[model samples]
Target: MIAILSDIHGNLPALEAVIADARTAGATAFVNLGDSLSGPLWPAETADLLMREGWPAIAGNHERQVLTHAIERMGASDRFASERLSAAQLAWLAAQPPVLALTDEIFLCHGSPRSDLEHLLHTVEAAGIRQATEAEIAERLGDTPAALTLCGHTHLPRTVTLADGRTIANPGSVGLQAFHDDHPLPYIVENGDPLARYALVRGTGVELRAVAYDHLGAAAKAAREGRADWAAALRTGLAG
Candidate 1:
């Protein structure tokens, strides 16, 4: 079985908890879907841990933006995340691809195969997030023929089946659970708790899992790093 994770966003405690839980749940292999260190908790430390594990990962929109976008074009959070990384870590992150194929049956990408910034299965409505129609999602998927396509960017756990029976999974965020983003549109992502999220795929089935960790500890780390917003998000999984 393989544990697929995404949007870890530098919360080492949360990532550790999710990995431990996945191990206990019989996952032997791991794939990361990116946005691994774009938060205030511990970008370099998180990257080092993942590097030590040698898990293959793709680049999320955050990763692309942080690496390629000019500093003047970056948001406050992006600037904050970029400043905390070492030159070596930055180089490593810049090297990750936006899309990867693990096998004939599995393909991994941050947001979608077409664009790292587009949501494959979600539309940002005024009320909140709405699941895109099957055709809409399939259009976003384009010509990829992988049976299972994994993506993450919105930090929400999701699974969708296209009309052709292909499955798309958003394993969700492993670290930061709640936040506001303004890239493609203004939207908020919250899971109602500061729990690490990932997914395990075995045989032909997928199981989304949330692993609770030391939220206060992560919050403390964020506070120490001068990110009160992150501290608050860690304490309460809300954009407020």
Candidate 2:
């Protein structure tokens, strides 16, 4: 079976927990959707783990940021400075391809097909989703028919069936969120404890799983790194 993951955003502990879960569930292959870097946690370490574990991954917006930085260092200054990526991290990110066609009928993207940074929310209309799907196909596969598109960016887990019968599966965020109230514990929380969102994809079926991990440990690390906002979000699974 294949384990699909995305939007990890450098939460090493959470990613480790998810990897353990996937292994326990017998996933032989792993497909990472994108956005593997850009957080308070170990970005380089996360990328190294994925590479060592042989997980196939696509490039996300953060990866683009790394590329842009490389261009800037080469005298092209149009890059986004907010990334603050290290040279080694930028090199690794630049090595990743923008898109990957997993099979004749399955595709993986960090965000929308049109743009790796675009957010394809579950609440979007069918027409919009269809348009995005077509744009993705044209840009990457060039008329190839894909039965399913797996993506993660909105951090909202969803399965949307389009009018043309195409399926879009969002496994949600492994390190962050795109939904949840301001409360301490929201809908998916277990007895007021926060959990990490994940998914396992086998054949045409996608099983969503939210596993609790060392939230306090992660939060403490984030705080120690002076990323208080990220630390708070880890504590509640609600992005500020």
Candidate 3:
């Protein structure tokens, strides 16, 4: 099966838990849709882990930041906060491709095919979603043949079949849950907590799995990093 993940945002613990879960499920290969950096901690570490694990990952907006930082650093220009990342990390991020056409019928991107920063969530109105899907298909597929497009940026898990029969999938954030005040829980909670979220895509079927991990630990990490907003949201799963 294809193990798809995205929007990790540098949460090593959450990523580790997701990886462990995916491994247990016997996923032969992994496809990462990016946003691997920029979070409470471990941006460089997360990139390193993905490299060491030999997983193929596409570049996200954050990765573009890293690349821009490197260019600025080389030119002796002021770098953004993220540009302060380690040289090794910058190199690794720079090396990542913006998109991955995995096979003749599968395409992976950090966002929409039209833009690396686009948000392709299925929660939108059908007309809007259809418009976006058609535009993406035209740009990426272009009559090459039918292909499965996988993307992540909205941090919301979704699987949609457009009016023209094109398929799009977003596995959501492996480290952060989509904002929902009522849910008030990050994707994963501690053992048997039933809050962790993930998606499995094999062939024409997509299965979303919300398991439990250690919310307390994740929250503590956020707190330790002085990201009160994130920590609070971890409890409520609300972005703001």
Expressed as tens digits, the lDDT of each residue in 1-240 for candidate 1 is 999999898889999999999999999999999988877778878988988898888888878888988989987667777888888888888888889989999999888898888888788777767777888889999999999999998888989987788999998889888887765667787788888889999954789998889999999988897888888888888777
- What is the Cα-based lDDT of residue 201 in candidate 1? 96
In order of appearance, the predictions have TM-scores of 0.94, 0.77, 0.77
How many clashing pairs per prediction, in order?
Answer: 0, 0, 7
Question: What residue runs in model 3 are displaced by over 4 Å at the alpha carbon?
Answer: 69-84, 122-146, 178-194
Estimate the TM-score for candidate 1: 0.94
Error of 2 at 239 (Å): 2.9
- Residue 54 accuracy (lDDT) in model 2: 66
Per-residue lDDT over 61-171 for candidate 2, one digit per residue giving the tens place of the 0 to 100 score: 766765665654521111322244567656666777777788987887777676675555432342222234544433442343578788876677777665566677878
Quick one: best lDDT, which candidate?
A: 1
Candidate with more favorable, higher lDDT: 1 or 3: 1
Relative to the true structure, candidate 2 has a C-alpha RMSD (angstroms) of 7.0
Candidate maximizing TM-score: 1
Candidate 3 lDDT, 61-131, residue by residue in tens? 76776566555443211132264467777777778898778887788888666667555543234222322
- Candidate 3 Cα lDDT to native: 0.66
